[model samples]
Every structure is written in C-alpha cells, then in structure tokens.
Target: LSLTLYALPYTLAERIAGPWSGALAGALGSGGAFFLFFANTTDYIPVLLFSFVGILLGFTLAWWRPVIFYPFIIIWNFLLFRLDERRAPAQTPHLLHRHSAFWDEFQRLPLVGLDTHLLLVMERNRQEAEAAMAYLNTTRQRWAARAAQIEQDARQLMACHSIAAIGEAYHRLSTSEATDSASALLRSFSRISQDVDAAMRQESAYNRRLALSAVEDRLDGLLRELTRSNDRYAARFRPIAAHWREVVADVVQQLAEEAEMRQEIDNPYIIGVPLTEKQEIFVGRSDISSHIEQLLLDRRRPPLLLYGQRRVGKTSLLNNLGRLLPSTIVPLFVDLQGPVSQARDHAGFWYNMARSMIRSAQRQRDLILPPLARDALAADPFTGFDEWLDQVETVLGEHLALLMLDEFEVLDMAFARGRLDADGVLGMLRHVIQHRPRWKVLLAGSHTLDEFQRWASYLINVQVVHISYLREEEARQLIECPVEGFALRYEPEATARVLALTRGHPFLVQLLCAEVVALKNEQPAEERRLARLVDVETAVPRALDHGSFFFADIAQNQVDLTEAEVLRLLARQGEETAVPRQVLVDYFPSLMALENALIRLQKRELIERIGDGYRFQVELIRRWFARQPA
Candidate 1:
C-alpha cells in the first residue's frame, strides 16, 4: 500500500514535469550515489565469524529516513576503502585499458564549414586580374603590327646606347675619381634616352589605331560569315521554333482560361474576375444608408456626402439603400451620368421616378401609388417641372419619396467645364429639399467632399458615411474561406503571403485567389502547402521597356515593366529602413510612373498611406508577393 502511494506520487510528478525533469532525475541519482557510499558502515555492522551478512540491507529500509540512510552509505564506503588498503595488493591490481586519442579528437571535432574569408579574397583577386588581362590583350591585339615593330626597333637601338653609356661610366668610375665632365655625359645619355622614348611612344600610338582598324575589318568579315551560318542553321530549325512558339501560346491561353475561372463577379467596376468563394458586395457609402435608416427609425434626416475616387463604389451603396426602404416610402434611384441638359430637365427625373414607383407599386396596386405613378407617367415628358412635382406630392404624401441621386458631383465637374448652368441646377435641388421636409434626399458620388462642398444647402440635409475595405482579419478570413478544407487550414505563411501580395484590394485579392485556385485545382489541403507551390509568373511589362505593348497607348507613349519590377523590388526590400530611388531608375528607367500608379492604387484602396510610403492592407498579399520567385 505504501509502495503504491509512493508510486502514485512519482507517476503524477512525471506527468507534470517540464524542462526541469531531467535535472531532477540527475539530482536524484547523485543523492543516491552519496547515500550508498555512507549507509550501513562502521557502527551499524556486526562482527562477522567467517563471512559477514551477505544480504543487501536496502530492501526493507527503502522507505526509511533519507537523511540517516545517506550517512550509512558514506561510512560503509570509507570503511571498505580502509579495509581494502590494509589488504593484499594482489586483490586490487590496476586494470589495463586501451586509450584512443583518435576517438577523443573525433568526438571533439569542430563544426563543418569552408574558409569563407580566404575563398572570397581569392575569388575577388582572380576576377580583378582576369578583367585587367582581358583588357590588356584586347588593347594589344587592336594595335598595328607594323607600327609596333617600328617601336620595338627603336627601343632596341635606344637600349644599345644605354648599355654603351653604362660601360663607359663603369670604366671611368673604376679608373679614377669621377670628373665633373662625367655628369655631363650622363645627362646627354638621359636626354638621348628621353628622345628615343618619346619617338617610340608616338609610333606605338599610331600602330594601335592601325591595328584596331585591321582587327575591325577581320571582325566584320567573321561576323558576316557567322550571320550566314546562323541564317542557314535557323532555316533548318524553323519548324522547331514554330513548335516552341505554339507551346508557349498554349500555355498563355491556359492562363487566361484560369483567370476567367477564378473571377467571381462579372461587373464593369470590378477590374478583374473573382478567384475565391468570398462574396464581394461593393458597399460604396454606408453613411447614406445609416442616415436613411435613422430617418426611417427615428423620423429625422441629416444631409450626407458620399465621396470617393472614381470607380470607388459610391453609387452602388445608394442603390442598395433605395432597395431597403419600405414600400410606403417611394424610393427613386437616379443616375446623373447624362449631360446637364438631361439633369436640368426636371420632368425627365420625375418621369423616371414615376416609372420606378409603378414597378414597385405594381406589387400592391390597391396601395394608391399605382394610380398616382400611372397618372405621372401618362403626362408629357416636357410638362412643367413644378406642376409635376406638386402632383407627385399630392399622390404620395410629402414624407414618402426617398430621392437617391448617384454621381451628384458630376454636375460640379460639368459646371467647372462650363457644360452646365450651375446656378439653375443648384437652385432646383435646393428648392426640392427645403420646401419638402418630408422628402429624404441621399446624394452620392466618386469625388472628395471638398469638391462638392459648394452644394452645402443640398448636402446639409443628409448624413455621410465612408465605406472602406474589409479589416485585415476580415480580409484574411474571406481570402482563405474558399480554400479551407478538412485536411488542413491555410498555413499562416501561405495566407500571409497572399495578403501581403494583394494588399486587401478587393478586385486584386479576388483576381490573385482565382489564379491560385486555378493552379491548385481549387483544392485546399493545408494552409502553407502553397509554400512549395509555384505562382503564375507571366506578365508583359511593356511600360518598363520603352516601346513595349502597354506604353503605346499612354500619354508619353513610354510603356515599361517598371510597375511589375517595382512590386518585386518592394517585396524584397523587407524591413529596410529606406531604399534608394536610384536603385529603381538604374534597373528600370520607368520608375516615375510608380508614383502615379501608387496614387491611383491608394484611391482604389489597394494600399493605404501610412507615413512616407504604403504597406499592404492584407499581410497575406505581401507574403504572397514575397513568395514569388525573382
């Protein structure tokens, strides 16, 4: 029972042990060694007749006081050692064992590595010497042989004079103390040598140009021969190049097919097809909806501004809000895309509103809107605007119409270009909101609020809400939702890569996912499974290369691969404090377009302005960019 209890504690201890468990085991062994040396020695031992008790004493006292048990082993060891020394030396002879110095050295071996410093120094020196020698050989070969021969002859003639002077000077020095005239002879030899050197240098220069011309003539002949040979060879292999071209063309077509498969939404505003299963509803401006909802719930209206960059989804949000309004309230969805003439014709807007009301009211004809909308539509298109609006108020109560005007800022742009009567249009809209307190007006557009602030009287009546991109967490979940499978979730690394690359841009995210799914056959096994996968790597960057396919349509006609290369460079510039601008220009001269593209990207919310530059909104997009092979 006691053993069982002690065993239980040890088992429990083992189950809960952490990093300290190994140290604990080592400590127990060391304590036991000391206990064995001290225990059952000296005072506890009885006098043996012939042989002492052979039985081990630890079995019955295994659970006894540890402190007393430890001291007994210590005394026992001391007495045994004392007894052994006093005994015959034959019983305790030293044993022989082989020592292995090689084994010891092997066990103490250093980690493996080549001598990097020596290798680098040798490589650099070899490269420098090779380059210098190649340059010297090229220069020597380019010189005229005839001129060089003349220079060599001149040097030989000069060398004989130098030798004769040295011999004379040696004889003069040995014979007697050098005379003052000896210096004069030496000076004359130096002048003669200088004259010879200058003549040789001139000859050498002339020979170089002649030799270069001759080399060029030989090179030109060789080039012509090589070109003829290549042309013949190419003619022989014409069918093979054609076959390779066909294969490449098939691969490109497959990529396009893959893109079409991945694109989810087939809409004009969305730049690309959706590749993932995530739903992308462009809610451009929620402030208008929230304010409208507030008015319907609390019976109050506040002016609103729906401002964003072009194609930023502002118009879509208002359409959604109009759909959400109750049937009792007439929802008029208006498009201001037409010319100012259409806008100024109040009767056309009223006619369109009547048509929308008729369509909705057809569901409940007995609700009184049917007859009223019918009567409005039956009226002439050129009917007085004031009379039509008054008739509309009489038909549907003053508080019934939810007038949603999309692209209101188009008028501002039109007026700036002198395409519209701005005062008349403003006066008309201002009159509708001010006179009809019951009517709720929602104005939306893809312009900044500052651009349309001039319409204060009309805007002051509604609330403005800025609808932005999905939060990082939301975007990540949305991106991975399509690929999440029973076998594995998206690996953090793979998901991070996707997010990092797309930067949470809705269209881009979907487009990228579509491409990825096309590659993976839409199979989701493990998150980071794509870490080993290859990406779609083909893109024509004509803008980066001057006169490329893309730049021909642009303003300066300077197309390039700069945008593509910049993306790659930026991804590799991870954690860098700053990257020099010249690095970009040196590699791809179209870097100036990057700033313009970045601004456009921001407007579309592909990237966010942080400080000096931008970061991907979706980290996975950045990670995906990082995973792309250079």
Candidate 2:
C-alpha cells in the first residue's frame, strides 16, 4: 500500500511530462518500492527486476521510434498483468475487491492517449486538401483571363476592314492559345473576311452574290458548331456570332442596292496599273504571243526586242508569258523599273536578279530553285552569277528558260547615271546569248535598238516584235465582255463609235468604256444596261479628263518642240482630216527638222501617213492635243 501510494505521482508525471521527467520521479518511487518489498519479503525480487527491464526497453523504443513505442507499451503491460495473475492468484481477488474502481480508471488511459496520434494525422490531411483547392482556384482564374483576352482579339478581327489588319488580328487570336471551339470560330471569321473582300472587288453583281453566298454558308456551319458545343465560353461568344450574321446580311443588302443603282459602274477596267496574268480583262495579245513563240523556236535564239509605245501593254505581256508559252518553257520576268535597276553595284544587281528568279520560278511553276546568298557574289560577281546559273540549268533539266527583262530603258538609265558599267553589263548579256544555248533573252522597252546605239552594237540579230493597238474584234470583246457575266451591252453603232474614238488602242478602249458606264449610271436604272451612241459621245470629255495623264505624257515627255508643233498642226485639221506634208513644211523653217519630227512622231505611233498626208493615229489623242495651248 505504501509503495502504491509512492508510485502514483511518478505514473502521473510520465503521462503528463514525458519520459525524461517521469524517469527522475520513477527512480524515487522505485527506491521506495524496493525498500518496502525488501522489508516485507524478498520472494518477488525477480518479478521486480523483470518489470524494470521491460520499462527500460519501452523507453529505448520510444526514443528511437515513437510509433512502435505505443504498441510495445501495451504489450509489455499485458504480459506483466498475466504474470501477476498467475503469481498472486490468491491475493488478486482481495486486491480487485479493494481497488476495482482504480484499476478500471487506469485501463482507460491508453485509449485517451491513442487519440493524439490520430489527431496529428487528421491535421496533415486537412492542410493538403486546402492547398489542392487553392491551386485549382488559381488555374480557373488564369483560364478565365486568357479566355477574355481571346474574346477581345476576336472582336478586333471583326472590326478590321483591310486584309492586312484582319490578318494581324487573327495572328494575335491564334497565338492566344484559345480553346478548340474558339480557334475554329476564328478561322471561320477569317474565311468570311476574305470572301467579303473578294466580293467587294468583283465587277459583276452576280459574282459578288456568289462570293457572299459562300460567306453565308460558312457562317451557317459556324452557327451549327456553336450550337453543338457546350464550351464554358460559348455564352460569351453568342452575341458576337449574332452580330456577325447581321453584318453579313447588311453587306448583302447594300450590294443589292448598289447593283440596282448601276449595272456596270463598279469600273472593271484597270487604269495606269499593268494587268496581272490572272486578270480576265487582259485581252487580245494572242498574235503578239504567237509571234514571240515562233521567234523563241529559232535555232540561233536571237535576243528578241518587244518594241512598243508607252502604255502599250508591254509589261503586261511579259507578266502573262508564262501562261502563253509551253509548260516546258519557264518565263523568269525581271522588272528593271523596280529594285534591279536601283541596285548600286554589280553584286547587288546579281543578288536581286537571283532573288527575283527564285521567287518567279516558285510562284509561276512551283519549281524550287537553289538559293544564292548575296555574300556569294561579293567577290567576282559575274563569275559567281555564272556558277549559280549552272545549278539553275541542272534544275531546268530538259526545259528551256525564257528570261524576259521589262523596261530595259530603266536599266539603261542606271548605266547613263554611271551607277552601272554599260560595257560590262551589255557584254555579259551578249556572252549569255552567245554561250547559253538553253536560254533565250527578251527585252521589252519603248525605244528601238537604233535609238539605243550601245544596245544595237551588243545585241546582234535582234528580232523586233511590235505591240500595237488591239484588233477590232479584240476591242469589241474587251468592251462587251471584259469578264464573265458582263453587265453592260453595247449597240452596234455605239461599239463602232468606241472603235473610232479609241482606234482599238487597249488602254483607250477600257478608258472610254469605263466612262460610258459612268455616264449610264447617272441616268435611270432602265437605261444603265444598254450603251447607246449618245452615251459614247457624252462619255468622251469625261474619258479625256480621266485619261489626262496618258494624254499629257505624250505632249510633255514623248514629243519635243518640233514634234509637238507637227501634232498640233494635225490636230487643227479635224479628227479624220489629214494635212499634206507640204502643209507641214510651211509651219517649220527647216525642212530636214520638220521631216525628222514627222519621222519621230510616226515611230511613236502618234501619227500615220494617210494618202500622202499624216493624221492622228487615235482620235482621242487628237482631241486631247487640240485642247492643249499652242
């Protein structure tokens, strides 16, 4: 009883203050228990020693592994209880009767202690769950912000008017890493934008309607996709989709109203700018193309000259030669009016040439040519260029290359300015013509070989192919049907009047017909479709005003003082009337100077000798000259 009372404080200290503090108190309790046991009897000395060893093992385990220590403590207590039951069976009943409540309270202590470990595990799980929820919330916020940015970019795409601006907005939207539905919808909008641009550029209302119908079809598919998708951002895009539909409908209605106002006032004719190969309005070059093809087949492969007056479709012919020639014959067109003539040195010139050749081959025939770096031509440029041509020839295989140099006069200007060496440049061309059997060269210019004496000396056996006004039938085709589903019709007399005024000149024909369409548009809708002779007459002054640049170039640049006087004299004589050479001689002091001016005027195709007299070649030009001050 004394030992039990002394051990009570030590057991309570072990549960409350941990093993080290409890050990100090336990030493005192153990000393008292030993003293009491020795005083009473020494029979339980082995059991006391065994109990001390078990307590030491439990402390050792608790210091190393707290998890194992709890189970060890439970097992050790059970073994001790069993041993005491066997050794003190007679005393157990008396002790149980006296201390039943105390033993029951002691058994409940382990259950209460086990709850601490479970509480620690529960706290760790709670912290992990909270961290996971925070990450998910942050991810959701980031996705929402990205989706909002994509929506803003899509709105900017819709507001774009030009192809360049639309493309830029689409680039931003695509790079935003939008959802699949958003990407698909952006692509649909891009297609619709392209279709609308094409429709606005179309000359015929019928063609415009076809393009707009394509836009409508694409929009319908997009609407169906939007309906099927359950994307979170779907609600955000619904209003934008509806607005796009309304915009397309408004475009359709506006085009319909415009169609009714004027059937052909969209002005299909291209003025000043050279016609592209794909343009349907480029008509009546078959004869010139055929002549060029025949010359190309010559055994000597002479350097051909496409000689014509200014604005006579020379560059246009060069641009379209790929379509005219056989597929085996590749046309590499270099426009000297651009960077080629502007190059400062031989290396720069050859580099630009190579670049143009490569681009032209790819664009025209889908043929990939070997690349040439500008550094490759830094030293010995001509030799470097020649070596590159060897690679080009290997790519050509059995095909022939037709190199067409347009506006050769511009390159000549470069030479005259001393920016280029005339001898070195012309000699290289001469060497190419003489040495390269698989290559043919064609130079298009306004001046004749005789005018450029240097070119006359270098390019021997040059065949001249003159490009003039269009044929009568070709002019008619251009007038009535420039493109498929042409909206305007021409009466026979009206057509004949156009032929008289333009003299079948390609530029003048388009100019006069465009003016006639403008005139008819001002009248009632009923009179817009068919052009009458009165419409042709009423459109003349407007045509002259609209084509003032074409007319003024002839007076200011193409002719000198003597040639201008000769033109004015011819203009004074009516449209059809011709002045005899004898009449022209009276206006000039020097006969030789008068004859020289007449020869130059005729060579320019501004005048023609008709029945021993010279008359204006185009009536429109004559009227333009008549309006000019003497």
Candidate 3:
C-alpha cells in the first residue's frame, strides 16, 4: 500500500520527463516510504522486497520500451496492494482507507493539479507542432512547383529567336509572378537575347554566329552549375539550363550554316532608329538641354513646344532628358506614337498614360510612383488619374515632374479619329500647367501650335524651342568620334565633303557615314582605315539609296505638287546655288501660290531662305531630289 502511493510520483515524472527521470524519482520515493513506514519491521520483508524489485524492473522496462511503461506500473501497484491485503488481513480495511485518503489529498494539492494542467498543455503543443510541420512541407512543395513552372517558361523563351517574340517574352517575364532572383536572371537573359538579335541585324553573319556560339558556351556553363546545385533557389533556373543550352547550340549551328551561304557585313551606324538612353552614340545637344533647363526655372511654368522636323532627334532628346536635367526633376517620357495614342477611349488613354508615367519614373529616377489601376479609372478616368497624380506628388516630395509627350501629332491624329476628346485632353494639359506647381508639360512634334488650331487656344503662352540639324561642331564630333574606339578615320577633305553633303542633318550624316564604313570595309585592309574624298563620293549614292524612305516622306507626304515643284527646281539649281523667289514664281501658276509653297516648305525645314532666295536645307536631300524623275 505504501509502495502503491510512492509509484504515483514515479508515473508522473515519467509522463512529464522520460524513463531515466522516472527511475531516479521512483528510487527516492521508495527509500522515503521504507524509512517512514517500515523502518524496523521484518514481518512484511518479502512484500517490501518485491515492491522494490518490481519498481526497478518496471522502470527498466520503461527505459527500454516507453510504450508499456504506464501499464506495467499500474499492474505492479495493483499486485503490491493485493500482497499488502493478504499479508495483513486484519489491517486491510484501515490500510485501504488510508491509501484512499492520501490519494484524495494528493489530487487536491495545487502542485499536482498544476502538473495535470501542464500535461494537457503539452499535449496541445504536440498537436500544434505536427500542424506546423505539415504547413512547412506544403509551402516547400508549392515553391518547388512554382520553380518548375518558371523553368519551363524560361526554356520556351530561350528557344525564341525573333525580336517580337523576345519582346513578348520579356513582357511576360517582367509582369508575371516570380521570385526576385528568377525574375532578375530571366531579364538578364532577355537582354542578352536582344543583343544576339541586334548582332544578327547589324553585324555580319559570321559575327552573329560567333555571338550565338558564345551564348551557347555561357548557357552550357550555367547548366553545369545549376545541375550541381542543391539549393532551393537554384531550382528555379536548373530545369531550364540544359534545354536552353541545347537550343542555343542548335541556333549556333543554324547561324554557321547561314554564314557559309552568304556573309554580308553591315556598318555599325544606327540609321533611322532613334538613339535610346543606353546608346553612347548620341553627341552634343547642350544648347537645347540648357534652354530647356532655363525654361523649367520660369515661375509661370509655361507649356513648352519642342518643334522639329521628323528624324531630327526629338524622341532621342526626350529619352535622354532624365540624364541632362537636375536629379530633382523626374522626366516622365511618353511616346504618343505608341499605345498612348492607340487607345479606344478616355479610360484606356488615361490608364496607358498613368502606366507610362509610373514606368518612366521607376526606370529613369528609380522612384516608385503610386500605381493607377485600369479598373480604378473605369468609373471616372480623369478624376482617377488626377487622384493618382496627387499620390505621385506626395512620393516625389521636392521633385518636379517633367511630362514630355513625344510625337504629339499622333495624339492629334487620334483626336481627329474621335478616339479621344481633344478638348478634354488639351484642357487637362492646360489645367496641369496652371494649377500643378510641380508639374510641367512639354509637347514634341514636327509642327508648330499655329498649325494645330485646336491646340493653340488651350496651350497659352507656349514657349517654342526649335530643334534642328546638329550644329557644325556637334556634327563633326558625331562624324569623327560617334563612339569611343571608332576604327574608321576620315581625311580632312573627306570630312569636309561629308559635312557638305549632309549639311549637319543628323539622319543624313549617320546614313552617309554608315555607307562610307561599308565602302571602306570592302576595300583592302590598309585602305579600310582611312576614308578619302573619293570614298565620300562613292558612299553618296549608297546613302541616297538607303535613305530613300526619309527623302520620299518629304516629297510624297510633307509637300504638295506646288511645294514639290519648288524643291525640284531648287535641286536642279544645285546645292551651292539658292534659287530666287522670282525664279520659283515663273515656274508656278501664280505668285501667291509660290509664296504659300515657300512658306510651307520653310516650315517643314526642307528649304531655308537666304536673302531673297531658298535652297535645300540638306545637300543629301538635294541629291535625292536630283535623282528623282522630273
């Protein structure tokens, strides 16, 4: 009976701690029981000896297999109770009552009750631990699946070769949900893919093949590293690595075959394409940039009109304004020729504008602007856009927002098509200029405000900044040193001849120089380094051939019959000679008609008046006209 009472503490310790702690606790409890109840008794020696041995055996069994510990302990205590009753039958009832009273008192004790509550809490904690582990495993599995999907998509993107496909892939990668490292790695590959495509377009086939081979080698190395990696993050790129390497190897072989068929090398000059902010080919435009800065400082914040003819580098200048302006001024450039003008309604227009503004702010200044969702603009587009701008202003703090709308004429065309309300758009611009102290509006187009009567009223006090052909020195810098490590050099006479032919027209100069480079490359290795007067003369026809689109636009789209006639007559007079107004008048049916044609031609920047006569603005253009059918 005494041993049965002592076993309770041993069982409790086992439940709370483990078998070793239970054994230690049982030994202490049994020693106390022996000393307190049967210290000098030898009559019940067998029962006492059996109780001690049973406790040892039970605890030893518990240590070996904890599953049976509680049952074994209960049985051992029951056997001891029977043994106590049999040995001392006369005191059985008294001993049982004492045992019952002691158990009731132990259960009532605060520490014992508290231990029971702790056991309950521990059981609850065990359940919670299992639940947490299950959740972690599920999360890891989900991430593994996501990584697999990203790998598959990346492999498909790697197989794409066309610029349009690569552009679509980039858009998909940029907008899709992805891990940061995965997104960054895919964007890097997208840029490399674009470089490969550019080499195919601009360099020789042999060079393109070399580029493709290099890409293959790079992919192969990445495959080896990814295959060996055991990290979870590396899993995102691992599945794509081997397949991408295979695709690149196939592309390299295809390119090598194409190179063997016919290898034609294109010159490095970038013709017709507007220089991006990343391109180092853009030369000096300090004057225009300085003028813009001064206008930005004006307190009234008048709307600016950047007027220039087509292909005069208006877009390029706008693209680069973020670099030229103060860091406090953020340039949000929007090409109205793109999706902004193609929108079907006001909601689409404002949404596209807001999207462009956000993108440009991030890209140019690394500043995050408040996002304007399309759905937010579905109710009231203008109001929603205005609210978004208010949030953007908060983010900008002390910065000024320069809103540059390039190819504003395209938006006007949209207005004419009734795709957007001209009044609402122009009124918004006027309101921004007048009401928003931190915002400035600049419109870039080929035509002046007077030509667009609808814009003239809304944009009051418009400050006109004319962008024309490069200044002579700027043009010379562009020709001689378009980029660092330029291999081609021009003799003094050859450089003068190029300037005479191009008249510092940016497009014409690039076109002519590209042709000159192509011509030089075809020469002997020794002759290829230096461009002579003969080389310049030789490149003129090729330049005219390649730039026919630019010249044709001027003849067919910009000028009417009367203006075309005037230009052809000027061309016939030669590059150095300026045909007088009287000479043009005799050719026309009436003087009024000739004067109007001349004014229009001058507005187009196709011809310039020198003292009472007009001549072609660019000699290369004159040469194009000289080759045309009379």
Each model's backbone clash number:
59, 0, 0
Model 2 agreement with the true structure over 36-58: per-residue lDDT tens digits: 55665657776477457544533
Provide the overall lDDT of each model, using Cα atoms, as 2-decimal numbers. 0.41, 0.73, 0.73
Per-residue lDDT of 364-447 in model 3, one digit per residue for the tens?
Answer: 898878777788889998898888889999999999999999889899899999999999988888888999999999999998
Clashing pairs in 3: none
Model 1: lDDT of residue 359 = 37
Model 3: residue 515 alpha-carbon error in angstroms: 0.3
Give candidate 1's TM-score. 0.38
Per-model TM-score on C-alpha atoms: 0.38, 0.64, 0.67
Q: Candidates sorted by TM-score, descending order? A: 3, 2, 1
Poorest 10 consecutive residues of model 3 by lDDT?
Answer: 105-114
Give lDDT for model 2. 0.73
Better of 2 and 3 by TM-score: 3
Model 3 alpha-carbon miss at residue 212, Å: 11
Candidate 2 backbone collisions, by pair: none
lDDT of 2 at 238: 60
